[model samples]
Target: MHIEEKQIAINKVAALLKNSGKFVLSIDKNKDGFIDTGTRKITVFPDTPAEMKSYIENSGLLLIEQFETEFAHIFIAEKG
Candidate 1:
């Protein structure tokens, strides 16, 4: 079976977040995004979904939350 573009995109996000302990809050907007972990906050901007996913998945973590806006996506996930 072939994956749809949107699912592929989401799965990509999942994979990266799975591997990487960290993830850029929101990417593709060209502006830095913010994330809060109850104890800490982080801001980042990944060049692309692929890039962000690479970082997130490679870091060795799990769980991902995506906030969808008309302009961009907001992703939150666990850190290792």
Candidate 2:
């Protein structure tokens, strides 16, 4: 997704949560390729880990924890 769209989505998510509600997001940092799910092909948007983190924090959510796996970055944020 484009940056503007991503931010808008984040804002929407943030608006839905109650105060102190937690949001968990997992982003594939290496999503530069397409995925074939047998029946359809899914296009993954290329978004960096840092950019995603920034988006989460900038949406009035306080980042509480973050970690990375071999394939993705996971962020735990709370609506503040």
Candidate 3:
């Protein structure tokens, strides 16, 4: 993603956090669009995907999504 999109995604993720916690933020590029089909990294929030979902769902930020894993959970907030 571009710098602007990256910044927007970061802000969205930050707004989704309820408490003060560390989050992994990166750009995910294994997507369809050009922005999503490169060496993109993702911003993984310290909170689980569940927590991110709640905040994101209600934060009015409609340009991102959340994903998670089992052992090493991964949360991805993208700009759509």
Candidate 4:
């Protein structure tokens, strides 16, 4: 998704959360787009971890914890 669309989605998620509710997301760590094996199509604009974090934080969600795996970054955020 485009950056603006992604941010809008994040904001919507934040708006849907009840007080103290948690949001968990796992995103590809690589900024470089990769091909989808099933569809044989390449991702054109995947959000970077930094961008995703910024979006979540900007949406009025407080970041609780974040971790990185071999291929992805996991974010745990809470609606204040």
**TM-score of every candidate:** 0.40, 0.87, 0.28, 0.80
Ranking by TM-score: 2, 4, 1, 3
> Could you arrange the candidates by lDDT from highest to lowest?
4, 2, 1, 3
In candidate 3, position 44 carries an lDDT of 32
Q: What are the per-residue Cα lDDT tens digits for candidate 2 across 17-56?
A: 9999999988876665676789987776678878888899
Question: After superposition, which runs of candidate 3 have C-alpha atoms over 4 Å from their true positions?
Answer: 1-4, 26-80
Stretches off by above 4 angstroms in model 2 are 1-4
Error of 4 at 29 (Å): 2.4
TM-score of decoy 4: 0.80
Please give the lDDT score at residue 48 for candidate 3: 39
Look at candidate 3 and give me any clashing residue pairs: 24-44, 25-43, 26-41, 26-42, 26-43, 27-40, 27-41, 27-42, 28-41, 29-36
Residue 30's C-alpha lDDT in candidate 4?
62
Query: What digit string (tens of lDDT, one per residue) describes model 3 on residues 1-80?
Result: 33334445656666666554445433333332333336774433233345445544454444243443443444443332
Model 4 CA lDDT for position 38: 92
| Predictions: Cα RMSD each | 12.1, 2.2, 11.6, 2.4
**lDDT of candidate 4?**
0.85
- Distance from true location, Cα of 45 in model 4, Å: 2.5
Global lDDT scores for all candidate models: 0.53, 0.84, 0.44, 0.85
By TM-score, the better pick of 1 and 3 is 1
lDDT of 4 at 14: 97
The residue ranges of model 1 lying beyond 4 angstroms of the native Cα positions read 1-24, 28-46
TM-score of structure candidate 3:
0.28
